[model samples]
Target: MPLHPRPRALPTAFVAVLALLLAAGNGTWATTGAGAQDRAGSAPRPAALAGRVIVTVAGQQDAGRAAARAEVRARRVYRFALNGFAATLTEKQAARLANDPEVVGIFPDRTVSVAAQTLPKGVDRVDADRHPGAAIDGVDRGVDADIAILDTGIAPAHADLNVVGGKACVTGDATTRDIHTHGTHVAGSAAARDNGIGVVGVAPGARLYAVKVLSDSGGGTISDVVCGLDWVTANAATIDVANLSLAGGGPDGACGQPTTDPFHQAVCNTVAAGVPVVVAAGNTPGAGRDIASSNIVPATYAEAITVSAFTDFNGRPGGGGAAICAASGAVDDVFAPYSNFGADVDIAAPGTCTYSTLPNGGYGYKSGTSMAAGYVSGAVALYRAQNPGASPDAVRAWLLGTAQPQRSGFGFTGDKDAFAEPVLSLGDGSFPSPTPTTTATATASASATSTATAIRTATTNTATATRTPTATRTPTATARRTATKTPTRTPTRTPTRTPTRSLTATPTRTPTANTTATATATATATAFVSTPPPTATVVTATATATATATTGTTAAPYRVAASGRSANSNSSLYLYDRKPATVWISNPATTPPTVAFAYLDLGSAKPIGAVRWLVGADGTADSFRVQVSNDRATWINLTANPLANGPTGTWHELRITTTARYVRFYVTNPNADPRIGGFAEVEIWP
Candidate 1:
């Protein structure tokens, strides 16, 4: 007899009556006859089909009833990330449950396996070796952040690891101990203690939580993976970062939606709860050639930081080094041949011949995107330790913004897709200062006492000739005049001159001046001039002019608040970050040929006259539309007709006239081989 025998068939009339009753109880069926017709249209299968299925409940209140209606006992119930249960159900039962109003989705359980294919030098290559206490000196200085390794169980007794705690989700595994070596290798690559004897991880001594989702053989089901995420989400406050050195089957476009893709939903909830997830771009088996990273789960989700593998033979930037234990044709300092690529890949890291810890307190080398992701998790731990409450998006921004571009000396020879993603670098001096501080001095020589007022006026006029700087000064002059009688008297004598100077400045400064600087200068000047003496008035005026000059020094010609004011679907944050190497790729699975979009929020409604964007290597958009909106509900087309296709890796601009806070890009047809969409950077002009 089968483990799960098919249930006996029921009479059509009886099944129909049962369905109507269940629908009414769930408040999905109205007393009207039309409701009954709708229920009958979605009838269950005639015969039972045996299999395990995951049923995602629309709400916690519906779980019990939904399972009862299906007459199946749940094997596992998820709470934190997903409100659902895993159960064995016949095809007929699954179809009935899927029709339930409270059921979000029902997915067949699929096998998930470890993405093992690592390193001592991956740390040095990514520059993690430069961090304090990250060296292999046999001493544990201790790491401040906690990382969850969602793979096979970790080696609890390994001296080189600091496995603080863990939860086992796999069956027959009551303890969070590694019987297989994959999870142990991953843990060591991410946070192996900095001990002199063996090997040091990317972030030495980081607290490791072994959330074993895969069995000892390094294989499990989607339900098991979701269980691990549920555990992580429950303990999100304690886990700063999580790494999944594992992969399931093909991509799910509906991963962002609540109804489809349980793993994707779990990752989204985990990240939303403050724990950043880093996942592997699964290695392509057999062929040993690259494929789109979007072809894999978790990596296909935009919420997680998806990483691909690269080879760095000498553990340093710049090419010319020979490949060590890499696949044939794998070049040094380039993307690995067996690694996944394409637009979904956020970044790359040293993956070939990585040295790290294994099970039984052993040490060895492995190579694949799994190792690459582990290195990134370690980097994230290091970053989070310094930035205690940084959001997942902020961490992603930092990682991308600081990554080293793979161009010129950086090596892009083996990059199949040519997305040119930046490689991860954690050295202290690798990235630009987060809050770049620039000091600019503008000296305005007002003849201490100009005997001839006309000469002083003429000097101010000459300064105004430098349009950009003078534009910002006009407001400073008016602010000073309005705040004090002394400056007012001086300006009144040369009213025409003051007006001329202000007019000259308005054109250049009004559109691009930093509002914060102007406001700060105005407030400071007002406070100082409140009780001004003749000498104090002159000093304050000079200082105000200098402040005005400094205000424009850092302001870009046409600036948009691209920092934290944009949202996208099926895309990454790299689109507006102004980094050419960091490109945003649309999930081909999620993006339909007719419509795919990404938008920028200008913070508030403003005059937008033109848009400039750079395309990625995938291909150009065959037909694209630009729309603007104030509330993001009602949209007005900026382009009267769709823009024609253009070349890739080059800037394209669209001229338009509109006022809106939100500027949206709609790709009607992405003219690429895979029907994907992408953008390297976008700039809005006023």
Candidate 2:
């Protein structure tokens, strides 16, 4: 079976427990291995290693040793090794040995994704600055505190991060250098130095220890995670905070017990050693289920301090207005649409569209509860620095006790209890005082130079609307590079007065052939596409009135109320005029590889029943959403996940029931074909 999208990865039990869980992390798209075998055949490519499995042996270290010997006797080849008496094996071999008396259990080694960055707003929102630093008194800023980031890894050379040292528990390497941007973003949010070039962190002075568990592909196995936990446990005396911006399966039960669940015990032991473990509550929406009952690990564990996510309405800390999701109320703080909430969530922080550092000294935006957890980890580091003698339980108590409770309710059910309690401020009167520095705006430019730790002299204007920055990739830990090669303009569609028809829709123009040379260099580094084709000119043709509408009858024509294209292009009005020949295209040059979206505002109120799209060029769109809204303020999702489209120029219609003045077509996930996204015609039925 293939793995479905979930927050972080799936859950895994110890050697005694047999079930294997495979869930994806925040904002990652995973595909099951269904391709052909390779030529050499010694080992399958990591991305397509479907037959690879991790087997756990019961008992103690002695039992693991016995299991290894038994596997050899059975003619099974074991690759990786873990402290929990586990080893990686072939699927067939694992099944054959599962019934062995010495073998505890066998399961698949599932992949997880990297799931970061308006991190300071979240920190300030939690009130972490009051206790110490230049603004207050004493030495706050996590001067002596250490946080162990268990993720893809940290860029050891990033000027913004004070990375003291780390280990690659999964790769068996000593250097914990990050190639993926996920871990770097988390590290920046938790502790990007006070250096002025990039964004600041809650504990800018904290020492970061990268415990690489997940691979650069953003996935890993229970064995790898177990290795990381064991390493942290051995060094718990020096590490004060452990940030787990990853997640997996729900717990079978509570965390107090160690017999049934090894994961629970692993995290529990770390906490018992006085190191506070902060985890993401997850981005999976609980829908109707009480989130408290959900089984997400680490977050659900009683010993771990779980953090949820909120949208800062104005996209700034303490700033208020409209939220990322229309369903969220108009306020400074509101629950993020993707955030998981319930009794398990101890605190909420800004997680939507947070801009932070990328792996190779670059910076961009990311969103998820994983991003929210980073803020809490920084706060924990600050608290630990201020009170070196405070126990984990005492620190957790003060952190939760001093939080500012939310007053506004979440959407639909108006559930306030699920996430009403959050950390709005953090500060204690225990530290010393000193110099004052002016706060700088947290923003990144298109071509930023990787500079040393220093404050920025120029300030960037804060953005309030939901905007995705260009895609970025960190090729190596020692160098810096931008994913986008050419300068691309922002796509725009502003609605005019008349409702009968919308203004012309514009598709991004093809970049010059020269642009391809620069783009080709980035393909190897970014995870957005595995094997990209050679430079091929992507052409989007104007759709003519050839195809007939299949879904809805013509209603008053609606123009684009608001639209955001990932790249700049010329405008074409034929998109909404019932024409089938004209098209709207997205620019593939957008950094951070973002999806395009449009909000159509009906000129007047009307009964909307269906929406149809004629997809061209690329036959499929990986993921998208159709949502309706009244007054362009509150919106409702009509479908979940992306709809599978047909071949080029085929019209796909979605039926819905809603009377609204606004409709939005948002591409939440990027298409497999990065160069082109085409829509020949859009039809709305009454």
Best by lDDT: 1
Candidate 1 Cα RMSD after full superposition onto the native fold (Å): 18.6
Estimated TM-score for each candidate? 0.61, 0.49
lDDT of 1 by residue, 170-218 (tens): 8667878888787888788888777666877877788788888888887
> Would you give me the overall lDDT of model 1?
0.57
Report lDDT (CA) for all predictions.
0.57, 0.49
Which residue segments of model 1 deviate by more than 4 Å?
1-49, 62-65, 117-119, 132-138, 285-294, 322-328, 430-563, 566-576, 579-686
Query: Where's the lowest-lDDT run of ten residues in candidate 2?
Result: 11-20
lDDT of 2: 0.49
Model 2: per-residue lDDT, tens digit, 1-686?
Answer: 11121121121100000001125333211111232223463322122122433343444445445555545332122222222344555544443454354443334444555542233455555454453431322223335567788888889888778887776766455557788677888887777776556677777757788888777767776556766666777776677777776556533433343224545556666766666777786665433223455556655666677777776544344444554343322245556666666666666677766666788677877777777778777777665665563456545544543454354221112334533444434544111121222222211111111111112234642112223333121110100001111211112222121211111223344433221111101001000111111112211112211111211111322333222223332122223423344455555454433565554444345655446566644543566656555544444455423344445545454434346665655564454555434665565554
